[model samples]
Target chain A: MDMLEQYLPFFTKLTPQQQAVLSQNTTRHTAKKGEIVHNGSLDCIGILILVRGQFRVFTLSEEGREITLYRLWERDICLLSASCMLNSIQFDVSVEAKKETEYWKIPASVYRKVMQQAAPMANYTGELLAARFSDVMWLMDQILYKRMDSRLAAFLLEESQLEGGRELKMTHEAIARHLGSAREVVTRMLKYFQSEGLVALSRGSVTISDETGLRKLAEESLR
Target chain B: MDMLEQYLPFFTKLTPQQQAVLSQNTTRHTAKKGEIVHNGSLDCIGILILVRGQFRVFTLSEEGREITLYRLWERDICLLSASCMLNSIQFDVSVEAKKETEYWKIPASVYRKVMQQAAPMANYTGELLAARFSDVMWLMDQILYKRMDSRLAAFLLEESQLEGGRELKMTHEAIARHLGSAREVVTRMLKYFQSEGLVALSRGSVTISDETGLRKLAEESLR
Candidate 1:
């Protein structure tokens, strides 16, 4: 499929003239893993649609701790990154390439213009925003109500599923960053998990030695 | 100003036919305080715009603990309540009238149709969704990064401002529910605050005796 056809199916709903306008405006871009694609821009440079690879969208604290809000993978449309363009949304989130990522950057002006003219695009945008808001609500529930051990177990299980492997090539510090926790806290918890024979940690990687144990731990309700 | 003229200027941007559709489809609603307005269906009821009084929108854990996501005051548009009708947005949010409130409820189907046709309405909808998402992100930051004492103090200050008084007519359980914590935890913290001369507790209310002290403590950065 062509760029417009692949990333935005609503492209077909647009008139040929609008389609030509979109094609004329958008640029295809690629970045290597670990690159800071958007350095916490209040003024969004562009709206990104991940064509392949992964991107981690996160918020930062004054003390420099980071928490991953959500991740964008293939075919995901990013709206929060362009905070200024979207009136009433005041986001200070930064985006980083979690893997070698390719995406289409739609200039905020063009995206807004098309959305104004195309009902399909407008409806799709609303759906994307609502979905993102729901994700944040779910995270709030987890952090406020769930226990740290259970959250960690859940994270590990999710990471294993995402990677499709028993071994997770990630450091404790990385895990702490993702969970918005202290490195010492994550280290202590990982050591405890190791003692329980649920996971084996070596250097910067964790191997799921007992999936059932981890699953049970994840499901454990703590008050 | 009339309903559309007063609450939504976007109505003017629509054609006469579109305005008629909106007028024909919307209902003016009033509810007493403490009413459970929206029970959080996967299928949304309508798009609500608060014209008078206050409404609290919150999420409840399986354990029944509730943490407020945000509040809707006059002129606030509540899109989250109509989750299912908006494709891809799956929200489980319950809304209650915090005070005797009056609002305009636009039928979900009508709102969606109008949004699909009117660029101004679509743009406004995007703005509302983006704004709500930002609020959720801020809440997540507070829960993960800030200490309980600071969070509680901030909440009290905000409540005082909202109620226009130094004394808050709320119970420990009420505060705990807002913070998504146990009542005992809230009671302990309130006692601690009382011991520090930050507040005075009565039968069912908390009076801020030392606003400066509470503000200072709230501003204290925790490592």
Candidate 2:
């Protein structure tokens, strides 16, 4: 019960009997960094509530390109991975442990039963799904409207914000994978940023030298 | 009550009293083609259940480019437009009448109250939301991975199937808007398709001459 409360603050909204059922059915597990939590079409992955560390949800293209849809961090729910609970929502998307992560996994049956019986839980799930859809729409807008340089700059700024620092210790290949661009494209953009003194890039890291310049570059429509 | 049943078969799952409440509260309306059903930030648009004709849900870019996310027909619900029901799911996406459309609109408060009281209704809504998210992911995949010509061919084929015909009487500007490409880019591609004997294009229309050839062209990675 305490473990359930740790990941799900809404646990208190359920009746006492519902809380008992959920606590008894949920399993806590850990995954190592880069570990594939669920591959495409693994229908029993369940509703995962991340307790610590990061998880990435992404899809791979036929040409082996990777594009991240979104990330799950502490206290976030992995609803998309719980495909068994969702009717007629079949797609090829994967979830992986971005860092060594610990989470609580509610079995698909348990989650669905709880959701059916609990209005609060269903409303919360709906809200989460809506928020995720909004994120995907925003990403689509960026890809459709923004130029590569502006997108790269924006990505860097967002990554820096996520990491809570100006220095990002990520490879160009990693950045490209996140942005759905080629490594060469990301490297070229970083080089351009360096030339303009907006950022300093080394072999596997980028540091924002002029944060204001980078922000302005990100906001500007290069085309 | 029969009107409610026409738009939503899930109406049967509710109690008779609940059904009566829903029937009394729901508003039935029709819109002409190109009419905006709900604009951005109109948080009270409610749950729209399409009864006839087509509805398009899309997001517009700052540069005035339009990209379609999905279309709704008979029995489909416009859950995103019910922004007040979905906590923190605000965005700039708009829904429009693609053809002369008839729909049932349930006020947001009434819909939320019914959903909270009815498990089946809540589950149905979740399934609908999941399906929409799946669609957005598929679109993101097309944009991130596929080339323009290939995507255009696939879109035309899909459109032909949707309309149950080989001829699409849509202008290049309309096609470009759907594909999130420039009108010039769509014109150039259509001309190429013509030269390759895949399609015949006239003002405001495109006729698929050799669908197999177009499919092959679409599958080819002509980088």
Candidate 3:
């Protein structure tokens, strides 16, 4: 499948003609590691489909603390900010390349026009929005019902699955920030996991050695 | 302006023919206080317009906890749960009347047909979905960043505004559940607020004496 086909689920169903229009209209851009794809002020719409590499979606607090809400990799679309394009508001979150990345930036106007003329496009948008709504609901549930340690464990599990490997290119401090906890707390947990032989942690990376053990820990903590 | 007129922003851009079809094809129902409009198994679509009174949009967890995610009042529509109809899945949440409420329940087929034939309906659904997305984001922000006290205070202020009065009808236990905290915590916070001259509590109601003070407290707690 092509790039558009890979990212098709992120959008509404489209006819061949509408798909061709989108394919022709979408522009691919490359960003080096740490480069910002769209800052908080850019007023653009349509989905940002990560075709290659990884990116971090985050917002800064008033005290300059960065809150990492999500991490995106290949085939994932930034629907959170992309949906905002319909309202003409400046982007609320910034997208920065976690590594050298290539993505397609489609225009909101083109997408809207095609959606108006295509049944599949409208259905696709409905499905995408519904999925996003479910995601936000799950995140809310995690924040409300889970403890910091459980949240951290779940994040680790999610990251491991996303990377399709035991190795994670994330520091303890980074994980702490994502879980909204202190670095020291994360360090203690990591030490505990390391002692149990569940994970191996080095200076800037972690590798899960006992997936079943980690999952069991998460379940027990949740209970 | 009529009740439907408040929704004109969504459909104003559509052609007259489309507006006529939407206006004629829509169905309206009145729900008495505490009545359920849609339950977990109901599959209905179209926009639910709150023409009068109020409704509570909530979900029940597996543990039997009732989580009130949103309160829908006059002129507001329940755009989030419209997904169940589109996806043909069980409703993720249920809508119940907080007071005797009247609403328009447009069928999904009618809505889709209107969107195809009418520019206004299409515009309305798009704009409504965008607003719902923002509302979810704001709720997520509150859940993730705000403390229990702050969340409770914000909830109180919001409830006061929704009721259009200084007195709120909700009980302390209900408020505690909404904040996802213990009832003891809510009682303690209420006492503190009372000592601070921010609120006066009774058997099943809370009356705000110092709205400005409560807002200040919430703001401080958020920081």
Candidate 4:
């Protein structure tokens, strides 16, 4: 399938000429599960418009601890990868494929040219940038104000919605990385949740049994 | 001075007609020390270009804890205040005057129109948005990976840089709010710093006696 054809719905406001320039210059790339796609590169920067699979946009500490800034799903657009567009951007975020993923990569120069000529595209880019800022702020708030149990509960709730069911099929290690926590901490919290009868743990998955209890615990910090 | 006349250097990219519209519509506002200037207003959103004094951009929790996201000094441009320009921005940040401040208030509608008409202005806005993202991400990284002592040390170092002195005049309570910590915790850390001869504590002030030691302590977590 043509890359532009797949993302035409996303770029609905683009003129035909602008779309042609982007479609011709935007390249498609694929990554296997657990592959690091973009690192701290100075020259190679552009917008990543996800067409399929998932991405973990995260930061890795010098000590090697991982904390996910956020995740990107189908149709989500990322701008941190295009940090070179702004010399003032000192963000050091990495994008990793959580699973087999494919996306269109629009080079920064091409996007810049198109954006200069297209008001809709520029506005859309601005809005995307704004949304990402909101997501980062929300994450910071949760980490600062919310307790570990509250954060874990909220993450589980978010995962349940994404998975479309009660059971979450992820390891404690993966969950720890997502929450910027230790695996032992996550396991201990899971045990506490089980004791409270909020969730039931299986070999690799945890099922929510008392969602109301979990919800309250998740929002306990706010109150 | 006219608001536009004062900020003309910042908006050098604007066309003369665009300048006329923004200059005519932009208003100047004043805030006393410790006054709330912008709350959660959706309608009154716009760019805040500080001409003098300081602004603390931060978030407040229901429990009344305050954690500063960043600060705006003389000549700094803030886009989060103009968040209404992008409907996707869900950042709920408030601005407070750290000191008597005078700034230009470019309303969202006027700023949006000017941005759409001027490519340079649009690009500059994008870069500012990107820089803010970097600031937020850096704060999150510190909170997640760095220990309380390291974070406190780093905060003091930053304050020193901002104040251009080894002695800081901030109270422990004010310092705690900035670091998202408790006043008791900040006091305890100060005592430790004093005991180690790294700093000298007097009534309502902490003076750094050993800058190298403090710098090392500030960066200990990253190493």
Task: Give lDDT tens digits, candidate 1, residues A1-223.
Answer: 2578777878888889888888898898999999988878545777898989988888888789876777888999887666667777766888888889998888988888888888788778887888887767655665676566788998999999999999999999999999887787688678767755689999999999999988976885343
**Which segments of model 1 are wrong by more than 4 Å?**
A148-223, B221-223
Candidate 3 lDDT over B1-223, as tens digits, reads: 2345565565665566766766777788888999987775464555688888988877665455666776777888776546644562223677889889988876666667766554445555655666665565666566555666677788889888877999998888888777766678889989988888989988899999998888987897556
Fnat for each predicted structure, in order: 0.79, 0.65, 0.12, 0.61
- The regions of model 2 sitting more than 4 angstroms off are A148-223, B219-223
- Model 3 vs. true fold: TM: 0.72
Against the native complex, each candidate's DockQ, computed on alpha carbons, is: 0.66, 0.58, 0.29, 0.60
Off by over 4 Å in 4: A1-16, A42-45, A148-223, B1-12, B41-45, B164-166
lDDT of 2 by residue, A29-137 (tens): 9999999997877556789999899888877787987667778889899887888787757676789998899998888888889888786788778778888877776
lDDT of each: 0.83, 0.83, 0.69, 0.80
Fraction of true interface contacts that also occur in model 1: 0.79
Q: On a 0 to 100 scale, what is the lDDT of residue A162 in model 4?
A: 95
Cα deviation in Å at residue A46, candidate 4? 2.5
Model 1, B155-198: lDDT tens digits are: 89999999999999999999998877778988999999999999
Q: Which candidate should be chosen as best, given TM-score against the real structure? A: 1
By DockQ, highest first, what's the ranking?
1, 4, 2, 3
In model 1, how many backbone clashes occur? 0
In model 3, the runs with Cα more than 4 Å from the true position are A1-25, A41-46, A63-73, A80-84, A88-91, A109-119, A146-223, B1-25, B41-46, B88-91, B113-120, B221-223
Q: What ranking of all candidate models by TM-score puts the best one first? A: 1, 2, 4, 3
